[model samples]
Target: MDIKTAAALHRLRLASIPEALSFPALLIFGTGFRIAFDYDALVMPLGMLHGVLFVIYVVLLLDVWNRTKWPVKRVAFFFLLAILPFGGLYGDKVLKREEAAGVAAAQAREEGTVDA
Candidate 1:
Protein backbone atom coordinates (compact mmCIF):
# COMPACT_ATOMS: atom_id res chain seq x y z
CA MET A 1 0.00 0.00 0.00
CA ASP A 2 1.02 3.56 -0.64
CA ILE A 3 1.25 6.51 1.71
CA LYS A 4 -2.18 7.68 0.61
CA THR A 5 -3.81 4.50 1.76
CA ALA A 6 -1.83 4.48 4.97
CA ALA A 7 -2.75 8.08 5.65
CA ALA A 8 -6.36 7.28 5.01
CA LEU A 9 -6.23 4.38 7.41
CA HIS A 10 -4.76 6.67 10.05
CA ARG A 11 -7.57 9.14 9.59
CA LEU A 12 -10.23 6.46 9.64
CA ARG A 13 -8.79 4.87 12.74
CA LEU A 14 -8.66 8.21 14.56
CA ALA A 15 -12.20 9.07 13.54
CA SER A 16 -13.49 5.69 14.67
CA ILE A 17 -12.24 6.08 18.23
CA PRO A 18 -14.95 8.57 19.22
CA GLU A 19 -17.75 6.65 17.52
CA ALA A 20 -16.55 3.53 19.29
CA LEU A 21 -17.18 5.30 22.58
CA SER A 22 -20.34 7.27 21.82
CA PHE A 23 -22.40 4.65 19.97
CA PRO A 24 -22.44 2.03 22.70
CA ALA A 25 -23.03 4.63 25.39
CA LEU A 26 -26.07 5.87 23.55
CA LEU A 27 -27.35 2.32 23.10
CA ILE A 28 -27.05 1.61 26.79
CA PHE A 29 -28.64 4.88 27.86
CA GLY A 30 -31.52 4.48 25.45
CA THR A 31 -32.18 0.89 26.44
CA GLY A 32 -32.04 1.67 30.12
CA PHE A 33 -34.17 4.77 29.74
CA ARG A 34 -36.86 2.86 27.86
CA ILE A 35 -36.90 0.07 30.42
CA ALA A 36 -36.96 2.34 33.43
CA PHE A 37 -39.55 4.86 32.35
CA ASP A 38 -41.19 3.79 29.07
CA TYR A 39 -41.98 7.42 28.38
CA ASP A 40 -42.94 7.89 24.77
CA ALA A 41 -41.71 11.43 24.75
CA LEU A 42 -38.18 10.45 25.70
CA VAL A 43 -38.08 6.88 24.38
CA MET A 44 -39.14 7.90 20.91
CA PRO A 45 -36.35 10.43 20.58
CA LEU A 46 -33.84 8.03 22.08
CA GLY A 47 -34.82 5.43 19.52
CA MET A 48 -34.27 7.86 16.71
CA LEU A 49 -30.94 8.93 18.14
CA HIS A 50 -29.91 5.31 18.49
CA GLY A 51 -30.86 4.56 14.91
CA VAL A 52 -28.77 7.41 13.59
CA LEU A 53 -25.79 6.62 15.80
CA PHE A 54 -26.00 2.95 14.91
CA VAL A 55 -25.88 3.70 11.22
CA ILE A 56 -22.95 6.05 11.59
CA TYR A 57 -21.05 3.62 13.79
CA VAL A 58 -21.59 0.71 11.44
CA VAL A 59 -20.58 2.73 8.42
CA LEU A 60 -17.42 3.98 10.13
CA LEU A 61 -16.58 0.50 11.36
CA LEU A 62 -17.01 -1.09 7.95
CA ASP A 63 -15.16 1.66 6.17
CA VAL A 64 -12.18 1.41 8.53
CA TRP A 65 -12.14 -2.37 8.32
CA ASN A 66 -12.32 -2.37 4.53
CA ARG A 67 -9.82 0.41 4.01
CA THR A 68 -7.28 -0.97 6.47
CA LYS A 69 -7.83 -4.67 5.78
CA TRP A 70 -8.05 -5.56 9.47
CA PRO A 71 -8.16 -9.27 10.20
CA VAL A 72 -11.36 -11.18 10.90
CA LYS A 73 -10.57 -11.56 14.57
CA ARG A 74 -9.93 -7.86 15.00
CA VAL A 75 -13.05 -6.85 13.16
CA ALA A 76 -15.07 -9.39 15.07
CA PHE A 77 -13.68 -8.06 18.33
CA PHE A 78 -14.84 -4.59 17.44
CA PHE A 79 -18.27 -5.90 16.46
CA LEU A 80 -18.50 -7.52 19.86
CA LEU A 81 -17.43 -4.31 21.52
CA ALA A 82 -20.31 -2.57 19.82
CA ILE A 83 -22.76 -4.70 21.80
CA LEU A 84 -21.23 -5.36 25.21
CA PRO A 85 -22.04 -2.84 27.93
CA PHE A 86 -19.16 -0.45 28.62
CA GLY A 87 -17.16 -2.20 25.89
CA GLY A 88 -16.74 1.03 24.05
CA LEU A 89 -14.45 2.42 26.72
CA TYR A 90 -12.05 -0.41 26.24
CA GLY A 91 -12.50 -0.18 22.51
CA ASP A 92 -11.71 3.51 22.68
CA LYS A 93 -8.41 2.85 24.43
CA VAL A 94 -7.49 0.09 22.03
CA LEU A 95 -8.25 2.23 19.03
CA LYS A 96 -6.32 5.13 20.49
CA ARG A 97 -3.23 2.97 20.84
CA GLU A 98 -3.76 1.54 17.39
CA GLU A 99 -4.12 5.00 15.96
CA ALA A 100 -0.86 6.04 17.53
CA ALA A 101 1.01 3.08 16.15
CA GLY A 102 -0.59 3.34 12.74
CA VAL A 103 0.02 7.04 12.44
CA ALA A 104 3.63 6.62 13.49
CA ALA A 105 4.16 3.87 10.95
CA ALA A 106 2.44 5.87 8.27
CA GLN A 107 4.72 8.78 8.99
CA ALA A 108 7.75 6.55 8.93
CA ARG A 109 6.70 5.09 5.61
CA GLU A 110 6.20 8.51 4.16
CA GLU A 111 9.67 9.49 5.28
CA GLY A 112 11.22 6.37 3.69
CA THR A 113 12.22 5.11 7.13
CA VAL A 114 9.88 2.12 6.97
CA ASP A 115 9.03 -0.30 4.20
CA ALA A 116 5.92 0.50 2.24
Candidate 2:
Protein backbone atom coordinates (compact mmCIF):
# COMPACT_ATOMS: atom_id res chain seq x y z
CA MET A 1 0.00 0.00 0.00
CA ASP A 2 0.99 3.56 -0.55
CA ILE A 3 1.86 5.94 2.27
CA LYS A 4 -1.47 7.73 2.02
CA THR A 5 -3.40 4.50 2.24
CA ALA A 6 -1.31 3.41 5.16
CA ALA A 7 -1.98 6.69 6.93
CA ALA A 8 -5.68 6.43 6.27
CA LEU A 9 -5.69 2.89 7.59
CA HIS A 10 -3.89 4.07 10.69
CA ARG A 11 -6.53 6.74 11.26
CA LEU A 12 -9.33 4.24 10.75
CA ARG A 13 -7.75 1.82 13.19
CA LEU A 14 -7.57 4.50 15.85
CA ALA A 15 -11.09 5.71 15.13
CA SER A 16 -12.50 2.18 15.24
CA ILE A 17 -11.38 1.76 18.85
CA PRO A 18 -14.09 4.01 20.33
CA GLU A 19 -16.64 3.20 17.64
CA ALA A 20 -16.29 -0.54 18.20
CA LEU A 21 -16.48 -0.21 21.96
CA SER A 22 -19.36 2.26 22.24
CA PHE A 23 -22.11 0.49 20.25
CA PRO A 24 -22.56 -2.34 22.72
CA ALA A 25 -22.30 0.01 25.63
CA LEU A 26 -25.03 2.16 24.15
CA LEU A 27 -27.22 -0.80 23.23
CA ILE A 28 -26.98 -2.38 26.65
CA PHE A 29 -27.43 0.86 28.57
CA GLY A 30 -30.27 2.11 26.46
CA THR A 31 -32.22 -1.13 26.77
CA GLY A 32 -31.53 -1.40 30.48
CA PHE A 33 -32.50 2.21 31.07
CA ARG A 34 -35.77 1.82 29.21
CA ILE A 35 -36.69 -1.35 31.08
CA ALA A 36 -35.63 -0.36 34.57
CA PHE A 37 -36.67 3.28 34.61
CA ASP A 38 -39.50 3.15 32.04
CA TYR A 39 -38.97 6.78 31.15
CA ASP A 40 -40.32 7.33 27.64
CA ALA A 41 -38.92 10.83 27.43
CA LEU A 42 -35.36 9.74 28.21
CA VAL A 43 -35.68 6.70 26.00
CA MET A 44 -36.31 8.87 22.96
CA PRO A 45 -33.05 10.73 23.38
CA LEU A 46 -31.18 7.56 24.24
CA GLY A 47 -32.55 5.79 21.22
CA MET A 48 -31.56 8.69 19.03
CA LEU A 49 -28.04 8.54 20.45
CA HIS A 50 -27.87 4.83 19.76
CA GLY A 51 -29.04 5.33 16.20
CA VAL A 52 -26.40 7.97 15.62
CA LEU A 53 -23.68 5.79 17.03
CA PHE A 54 -24.76 2.83 14.92
CA VAL A 55 -24.65 4.93 11.78
CA ILE A 56 -21.16 6.13 12.62
CA TYR A 57 -20.03 2.60 13.25
CA VAL A 58 -21.33 1.47 9.88
CA VAL A 59 -19.54 4.26 8.08
CA LEU A 60 -16.24 3.50 9.80
CA LEU A 61 -16.54 -0.18 9.11
CA LEU A 62 -17.18 0.52 5.47
CA ASP A 63 -14.13 2.71 5.37
CA VAL A 64 -12.03 -0.06 6.84
CA TRP A 65 -13.24 -2.55 4.27
CA ASN A 66 -12.69 -0.11 1.44
CA ARG A 67 -9.23 0.90 2.54
CA THR A 68 -7.90 -2.54 3.36
CA LYS A 69 -9.81 -4.58 0.81
CA TRP A 70 -10.45 -7.11 3.53
CA PRO A 71 -12.63 -10.06 2.62
CA VAL A 72 -16.33 -9.82 3.34
CA LYS A 73 -16.12 -12.52 5.98
CA ARG A 74 -13.68 -10.47 8.00
CA VAL A 75 -15.81 -7.38 7.68
CA ALA A 76 -18.86 -9.33 8.66
CA PHE A 77 -17.04 -10.60 11.72
CA PHE A 78 -16.32 -7.06 12.83
CA PHE A 79 -19.93 -6.10 12.12
CA LEU A 80 -21.02 -8.94 14.35
CA LEU A 81 -18.78 -7.69 17.10
CA ALA A 82 -20.50 -4.29 17.02
CA ILE A 83 -23.79 -5.73 18.17
CA LEU A 84 -22.50 -8.20 20.75
CA PRO A 85 -22.22 -6.97 24.33
CA PHE A 86 -18.61 -5.99 25.14
CA GLY A 87 -17.54 -7.48 21.83
CA GLY A 88 -16.34 -4.03 20.93
CA LEU A 89 -13.51 -4.44 23.41
CA TYR A 90 -12.30 -7.44 21.50
CA GLY A 91 -12.50 -5.56 18.23
CA ASP A 92 -10.60 -2.65 19.70
CA LYS A 93 -7.97 -4.98 21.09
CA VAL A 94 -7.52 -6.57 17.69
CA LEU A 95 -7.07 -3.17 16.05
CA LYS A 96 -4.54 -2.12 18.68
CA ARG A 97 -2.54 -5.23 18.03
CA GLU A 98 -2.65 -4.59 14.28
CA GLU A 99 -1.44 -1.06 14.88
CA ALA A 100 1.46 -2.38 16.93
CA ALA A 101 2.41 -4.81 14.21
CA GLY A 102 2.16 -2.15 11.54
CA VAL A 103 4.40 0.14 13.57
CA ALA A 104 6.98 -2.57 13.99
CA ALA A 105 6.90 -3.34 10.29
CA ALA A 106 7.28 0.30 9.42
CA GLN A 107 10.21 0.61 11.74
CA ALA A 108 11.82 -2.39 10.17
CA ARG A 109 11.33 -0.93 6.71
CA GLU A 110 12.81 2.37 7.86
CA GLU A 111 15.91 0.64 9.15
CA GLY A 112 16.39 -1.08 5.78
CA THR A 113 15.68 -4.47 7.29
CA VAL A 114 12.34 -5.15 5.51
CA ASP A 115 11.37 -5.04 1.85
CA ALA A 116 9.39 -2.03 0.76
Candidate 3:
Protein backbone atom coordinates (compact mmCIF):
# COMPACT_ATOMS: atom_id res chain seq x y z
CA MET A 1 0.00 0.00 0.00
CA ASP A 2 1.06 3.58 -0.51
CA ILE A 3 2.26 5.51 2.55
CA LYS A 4 -0.83 7.69 2.61
CA THR A 5 -3.16 4.74 2.49
CA ALA A 6 -1.10 2.85 5.01
CA ALA A 7 -0.97 5.83 7.32
CA ALA A 8 -4.69 6.39 7.12
CA LEU A 9 -5.40 2.72 7.72
CA HIS A 10 -2.98 2.69 10.61
CA ARG A 11 -4.75 5.64 12.23
CA LEU A 12 -8.11 3.99 11.85
CA ARG A 13 -6.72 0.70 13.13
CA LEU A 14 -5.13 2.38 16.11
CA ALA A 15 -8.16 4.51 16.92
CA SER A 16 -10.48 1.54 16.81
CA ILE A 17 -8.36 -0.50 19.18
CA PRO A 18 -8.97 1.78 22.16
CA GLU A 19 -12.70 1.97 21.64
CA ALA A 20 -12.76 -1.81 21.29
CA LEU A 21 -10.79 -2.28 24.46
CA SER A 22 -12.75 0.23 26.47
CA PHE A 23 -16.13 -1.20 25.60
CA PRO A 24 -15.35 -4.60 27.05
CA ALA A 25 -13.46 -3.36 30.06
CA LEU A 26 -16.10 -0.85 30.91
CA LEU A 27 -18.82 -3.39 30.42
CA ILE A 28 -17.17 -5.72 32.86
CA PHE A 29 -16.59 -2.94 35.34
CA GLY A 30 -20.06 -1.56 34.98
CA THR A 31 -21.65 -4.93 35.43
CA GLY A 32 -19.51 -5.71 38.43
CA PHE A 33 -20.05 -2.31 39.93
CA ARG A 34 -23.78 -2.49 39.52
CA ILE A 35 -23.82 -5.81 41.27
CA ALA A 36 -21.40 -4.89 43.98
CA PHE A 37 -22.65 -1.43 44.69
CA ASP A 38 -26.26 -1.99 43.75
CA TYR A 39 -26.29 1.35 42.01
CA ASP A 40 -28.54 1.66 38.94
CA ALA A 41 -26.58 4.69 37.88
CA LEU A 42 -23.45 2.75 37.05
CA VAL A 43 -25.10 0.20 34.83
CA MET A 44 -27.16 2.16 32.31
CA PRO A 45 -24.64 4.72 31.14
CA LEU A 46 -21.79 2.27 30.80
CA GLY A 47 -24.03 -0.12 28.93
CA MET A 48 -24.98 2.62 26.53
CA LEU A 49 -21.39 3.69 26.06
CA HIS A 50 -20.24 0.14 25.47
CA GLY A 51 -22.92 -0.42 22.87
CA VAL A 52 -21.99 2.76 21.04
CA LEU A 53 -18.28 2.06 21.14
CA PHE A 54 -18.83 -1.50 19.96
CA VAL A 55 -20.64 -0.25 16.89
CA ILE A 56 -17.92 2.30 16.23
CA TYR A 57 -15.26 -0.37 16.51
CA VAL A 58 -16.99 -2.61 14.01
CA VAL A 59 -17.40 0.23 11.54
CA LEU A 60 -13.78 1.30 11.94
CA LEU A 61 -12.58 -2.27 11.51
CA LEU A 62 -14.50 -2.60 8.26
CA ASP A 63 -13.08 0.66 7.02
CA VAL A 64 -9.50 -0.39 7.78
CA TRP A 65 -9.95 -3.82 6.24
CA ASN A 66 -11.43 -2.34 3.10
CA ARG A 67 -8.66 0.20 2.79
CA THR A 68 -5.71 -2.00 3.74
CA LYS A 69 -6.82 -5.21 2.04
CA TRP A 70 -5.15 -7.12 4.85
CA PRO A 71 -4.99 -10.87 4.60
CA VAL A 72 -7.88 -12.75 6.17
CA LYS A 73 -5.70 -14.17 8.88
CA ARG A 74 -4.52 -10.74 9.94
CA VAL A 75 -7.99 -9.26 9.86
CA ALA A 76 -9.44 -12.17 11.81
CA PHE A 77 -6.78 -11.91 14.43
CA PHE A 78 -7.39 -8.22 14.71
CA PHE A 79 -11.10 -8.71 15.28
CA LEU A 80 -10.43 -11.47 17.78
CA LEU A 81 -8.02 -9.19 19.59
CA ALA A 82 -10.71 -6.64 20.20
CA ILE A 83 -12.70 -9.03 22.37
CA LEU A 84 -9.92 -10.46 24.45
CA PRO A 85 -8.52 -8.36 27.27
CA PHE A 86 -5.21 -6.65 26.46
CA GLY A 87 -5.64 -7.78 22.89
CA GLY A 88 -6.06 -4.27 21.55
CA LEU A 89 -2.63 -3.23 22.81
CA TYR A 90 -1.03 -6.25 21.18
CA GLY A 91 -2.89 -5.68 17.94
CA ASP A 92 -1.83 -2.06 17.94
CA LYS A 93 1.79 -3.14 18.06
CA VAL A 94 1.27 -5.47 15.13
CA LEU A 95 -0.51 -2.79 13.13
CA LYS A 96 2.16 -0.23 13.92
CA ARG A 97 4.88 -2.56 12.74
CA GLU A 98 3.00 -3.30 9.56
CA GLU A 99 2.39 0.39 8.96
CA ALA A 100 6.02 1.26 9.56
CA ALA A 101 7.16 -1.38 7.09
CA GLY A 102 4.77 -0.13 4.46
CA VAL A 103 5.93 3.43 5.00
CA ALA A 104 9.57 2.33 4.77
CA ALA A 105 8.96 0.54 1.49
CA ALA A 106 7.23 3.57 0.03
CA GLN A 107 10.12 5.73 1.12
CA ALA A 108 12.58 3.34 -0.46
CA ARG A 109 10.71 3.43 -3.76
CA GLU A 110 10.68 7.18 -3.71
CA GLU A 111 14.46 7.22 -3.09
CA GLY A 112 15.22 4.62 -5.79
CA THR A 113 16.70 2.42 -3.04
CA VAL A 114 14.57 -0.69 -3.33
CA ASP A 115 16.38 -3.88 -2.30
CA ALA A 116 15.03 -6.00 -5.13
Best by the TM-score measure: 3
- In order of appearance, the predictions have TM-scores of 0.70, 0.73, 0.78
Model 3 ranges off by over 4 Å: none
Decreasing TM-score order of the candidates: 3, 2, 1
The best candidate in terms of lDDT: 3
- Model 2 clash pairs are none
State the lDDT of candidate 3 residue by residue for 1-116, as single tens digits. Answer: 67777776577566666666776678789888888988778778888876786577667777778877879897788778777766777777777887888888889988888853
lDDT of 2 by residue, 1-116 (tens): 44444565566555555655555565567778778998556656766776676677778778767877889999998888767756666877786676666667777888889899
lDDT of each: 0.65, 0.69, 0.75
Which residue pairs does candidate 1 place in steric collision?
none
The list of candidate 2 runs beyond 4 A from truth reads 1-28, 35-37
Model 3 CA RMSD to the hidden true structure, in angstroms: 2.5
- Score candidate 2 by lDDT: 0.69
Error of 3 at 27 (Å): 1.7
By lDDT, the better pick of 1 and 3 is 3
